[model samples]
Target chain A: MPGIDECLLEAMKLPGARGAAVVDWTSGLALGTAGESQSGDHEATAAETAELARIAAEYQSFAPADGSDWSDDDTPVEDLIVSSRDSYHVLQFVRTTFDSSVFLYLWLGRTEGNLALARIRLREMARQLVLG
Target chain B: MLHRLAAEKATGSLMRERGTLYLSDGQVIHAESPDTPGLDVLLTAGGALSPEQWGEALTEAGPQQLVGRFLVDRGHFPEGALELCHLGALYDAAFFVLGRGGGPARFRYGVAHWMGAVRPVPVDAVQRETSRRREMLNEIWPEDDTDTQPLVQTGLGLDTGLPRRQRAVAELVDGVRTAADISRALGRPAFHTLVDVRRLAAAGIVTAARRPPRAANAPTRLPETSAAPDVSLLRRIKNALEAL
Candidate 1:
């Protein structure tokens, strides 16, 4: 299985990859970051992206007629993607029996990305990533 | 007839000119309106599915059985989650109705939505939690417009003796930050961050910024990310009377 750096290196191999980072969505902490900063404030953008993931989740869990349970702990999240005119922002959530709180964020160019292949590659990366 | 149809526990696309609202048992389970960002945005944002997964789900389902199961199925979201999404979809559609949000839309009723083997959350509890959030916000600002406006924190500076968490918030007082960003910085849960922000906002500790004027004629773009507190967010927190 590829480690964190290898996971990002693999993502950079995508057609229009711009930047990549492994972020803890819960903490807005970037374990590792590569590429030019989207807004010059990597920490701020990471926090904002993490917030987006969270609000969307809370909104879903609170819909009317909902019958599921949300344990009094952090829910496991999978992946998140935010598409804009120039780039695709991706967040992939990872879980290990020992720990399950890290995620990977990949930003790719809209034109350069082949949506299907990028998805497939990202899925593969998630399965193999090893975190410290 | 549709209301009656819903009462009968029917399933189908309940399309409206504005958008289509879906249901399984008089209670809404899934919704889609072309004039809005649609379910993909909400689902992707919520971390339930990746953009690629959502696309695949759309292609695989072919719009009828697929969207329904994608939402209702156990693996995708809990029933509470679907309901919340359904509401968001409706809100998005309602916001875009008569606007340029485009779609050839129609609602079909009486067909089984067949969301695959999903579990349900207690609706009442979720509603209560949301209401609690709303009330908390109201106590802080008591206004809806503040929600849409840019969030900026203009203060003197963080006091030295404050607790780490409050200090963290004080650090963010310079520029406007979102609840999500604050959550990430403090390493706290989103809800907890929201609660504190509201408390701070209510105590007159935080002031809401005015909304930006809408741009017209130009290709619309999302707002630029705001700046962070850099020794500038704090001003008078150190010496002002408790009343101020």
Candidate 2:
């Protein structure tokens, strides 16, 4: 498994990737960051993404209503993708035995980035990302 | 002091009453404290490894100073899992270890932690991270006194807005346990618990016990020592005046 910096570098290798960060949603702190942030300030961007992650993970409506009990798994939201006029942002949650409140944030150029590929790659990276 | 050590590229264990910080080539590789649960507890408490397996690995590789490597080589746990748990425990203990002020500290040259170095973080990076954690907590709740005080769940309506981890923490709060105690009981990182406790306080869902009165009554500042009269001379003059 790749460590935090390596994992971030791997994320940044995605086509048209502008920036990548591993953020702890609970504290709104960036554990690691690579490349240029969309907002220019990585800290502010981390906090902003954390707020969105918190909202998505906490709201009851986001919980899966399928017959299977959703409470068994801690993940309330799998991945969140935001598309803007010029860029795309992806947040992929990592499930762990401990509090699963961290997410990988990736920013990509709308024109050159493949949203589908980035999203798929992010999910895979989130699985193998070693936080230590 | 850590900067000086780092400058010299020191390799040793800095031991204090609160905990010990192990450094290799000036980088902090491991830390352990009684205030926070260690990697052993984190792994076994979560049922990732049985006690027997942990004991076997320790017994086999402890003398060789390859306990961590042995565990990983034996497939007891993935290297990533071990590193994560080790890092978590290291930082958790380091917070308290570094926070301890004016304590007797001793450094033993060439001493290394038994688990060995999983990932070495620069001394400056560790210090920056520690301060960042403090700032994060302050942002959530301005009061620093709540960090050590026993937690008391308030009757405020704010409890409903708590996140899942905070709710779990609130449920464990019995009005007697401090954040550190709750963290140990819940098998969570002490720093994470502190953050949640601060957030709970900020939300008015919980309150910390009032700080106790300090024993020292000394003034915050005093005049320059060179300008101040000698203490014995002043005492003698006062005694002479009283006798007169």
Candidate 3:
């Protein structure tokens, strides 16, 4: 039942978690953000991550083989993880009652963060994100 | 006027012909427009909240200007849901309000929306997103008339391979409904529906119902009983709602 701010605060507690945000991919708007962003600005980070989310969600090639035709329902891609030299970016998609176009982003340092655990927890958070 | 208000950290509503933008401490808290779907429509139309519940919420919490908090606290819906819808509705209306020059923008101080503030967006962010949306629509199809004029589905629609979302919008084009009408029917944001409409127009699946140009001596304003929304009256209604 955690709202956006509470959710982001929870995300920051993860080991080596630098920052987190909830973003609407369609509009490239960040609904909420917490902690420090390596990109210096949270808005800029939102737009960049939205681009990645849009690519994974929009393209047919990114969908699974046996999945139903991509319509307005939840996208087949569950989560996206990008590894840079020193950090990890994880985006977990949330299925809203109205529109399933939002995702939670977590920025983690490569050394202290557990990618597997972070991914699992993010999925849980996304599920707990009540839409209506 | 909007930028100046932001600079001065003013809190109130900015009234324009297209809509109203509510800013809290110089940041946008909410927006509403007659031509765009509101949060109530998005909620009830999307089936996320029943009309009865919305009515009850209004009766119980609207007077206190805590409908948003009340709904969340009552467990009728989550805060994120309300906030997200509010954000979408704001941007949808702000698109029409921004970058237009037909009428003047009047600012009133110390006023707040009854829906309450969920998030405060900077004026620059709102402006940036507005322009970005305009560019996106232009990139898909560079025409403004399709946004306001009645839309018609061409015979080419049956054969056109359109995406599912766009298909739904195209199917609603009866040569009578405008983009705003289609948007409210679909329970989606007007801007998103406009994107689909513009794409449909570009793909030849839909077109704006064309009309003959008026004579040079014709008045710029439409005749009485026009379909166009009444901005002044709408603004008064908005003010009355806030007062109540």
Q: Is the docking of candidate 3 incorrect, acceptable, medium or high quality?
A: acceptable
Name model 2 segments beyond 4 Å from true.
Answer: A1-6, A28-52, A59-74, A130-132, B100-104, B214-244
For candidate 2, the docking band is incorrect
lDDT of 1 at A124: 65
Interface RMSD of 3: 2.6
- Among residues 3 or more apart in sequence or in different chains, the pairs in candidate 3 whose N, CA or C atoms overlap within 3 Å are none
Question: lDDT per residue, candidate 3, A15-119, as tens digits?
Answer: 989999999876677878999888899988997898898778756677677642433355578899999999999999887666436899999999999999999
Model 2 chain A lowest lDDT segment of ten: A66-75
User: Where in model 3 is the C-alpha error above 4 Å?
Assistant: A36-39, A64-75, B158-161, B211-244
User: Lowest lDDT 10-mer window, candidate 1 chain B?
Assistant: B116-125
Q: Name the better of 1 and 2 by lDDT.
A: 2
Lowest summed lDDT across 10 adjacent residues in model 2 chain B is found at: B231-240
TM-score of every candidate: 0.35, 0.81, 0.82
State model 1's lDDT.
0.51
lDDT of 2 by residue, B12-39 (tens): 9998888989999999999988778777
Alpha carbon lDDT at B11, candidate 2: 94
